[model samples]
Target: MRTNYEAHDIPYRRKKAAGWPGWNSAEEVHDCIQTLNGLLEPLEVASTADVCEIGCGAGNLTDTLADRGWSVTGVDVSNVAIHWARERCRQQNVTFLRGNICERELFAPASFDLIIDGLCLHCIIGEDRDRVISNLSYWLKPGGRIVVFTMCGEPKGKDRAGYDPKSRCAFSGDIAVRYFAKAEEIIDEFRKESLQCTFQQVVDPPNEQASLRALFEKPR
Candidate 1:
């Protein structure tokens, strides 16, 4: 099996500084931003709302959200990435912090109006993954929203260069595996915990990398 460190390899700041075009490419990033923006169009978030981004590597989405006038706080496990985000996203309304999502304590209860979880979930496994999920309930305000983008419950192609999905638990694949979750599984988890799904979509890139993006709301 693969370790979490192996799965989350490559310093985001190093790649950003070297102009690595981000995980996939500029096209992927642009499409993600545009699609997420469109998905949030009818949400009606106030300009004064506080937005917190989990796993905001290099502040890519954090910067975009800040540009939309939200007070943004981005947290990532990478200190290098946090430093990079601070330098790259200079908006006065934005702040970047470094910490494990499972142990983060910088925010008070019922703090954020919106929490962004980008493509970071798929990189973790085992009890660590569960801790992150459970911790989400503590960080969000009642009636707040969470936007999650992650790999789906599809079979990985052997021919593809991407990580493979294992049977049973998503962690059984390998050290380099990218954990995937079904939309239904995600919704069910939230439902059991008193959250409701507002929207869900499976996005397939030209490269055949399919992902699910979902927006959920916690009951007030």
Candidate 2:
């Protein structure tokens, strides 16, 4: 995963855009920013809110939050990405850290007002998925919410060509790289960790697999 992203110049690209090192059209980048803005608008969260973004590659999404006046922390496992994020986001309210959320504690319990998955959860496979979700719950403040945008259900396109039903994962030459689960299954996983599902949107793009965008809240 690290090698794949390290080669890419930017982290957040429109769904239809070509892979990194390939530039997205101005319109596509605008649409991507709008999508991120749309996710936060409905929540009406305060600007004073503290946010943590997991897998915040290049700080693209983190920049959005910081620009909106929120204090933001961006975490990623890729050192290359972290360096890029820091260079991109120079706002005092923003901080970047390099680490795997699944491997160690990134913050104290009840630490953040919001946690954005940064579209990373789907990349986690096996029991690590459960452990990461559990840890995300642990990091949230009472009544805090998590925004998860991830691939769900069966794979499509090239992903389908390499899908493994038994592991529910998509592969690249025998390496399990991405997991796809039913939307219901994903909701259940968060609920099991005591989070409440507040909103859900499942989208199936043309010639692509489905993606789930949901908001899960920790009970106060």
Model 1 ranges with Cα > 4 A deviation: 5-14, 21-24, 104-106, 155-177
Cα lDDT tens digits, model 2, 1-220, are 2113222223343322343321234564465567667778889788899999888877777887899898899988777677767876799999999888886467888889999985678877777778899999999999999998878988887678677788788767666767898999999999999999999999888886688889999999
lDDT of 1: 0.73
Worst 10 residues of 2 by lDDT: 1-10
Per-residue error (Å), model 1, residue 51:
0.5
Per-residue lDDT of 31-145 in model 1, one digit per residue for the tens? 7788668767878899999998888877777888999999999988777677777877899999898877867476677888988887777666655666676677678989899
Give the residue spans of candidate 2 off by over 4 A.
Answer: 1-29
Error of 1 at 154 (Å): 2.5
Worst 10 residues of 1 by lDDT: 163-172
| Clash pairs, model 2 backbone | none
Which pairs of residues clash in candidate 1, taking residues 3 or more apart in a chain or in different chains? 1-175, 2-174, 2-175
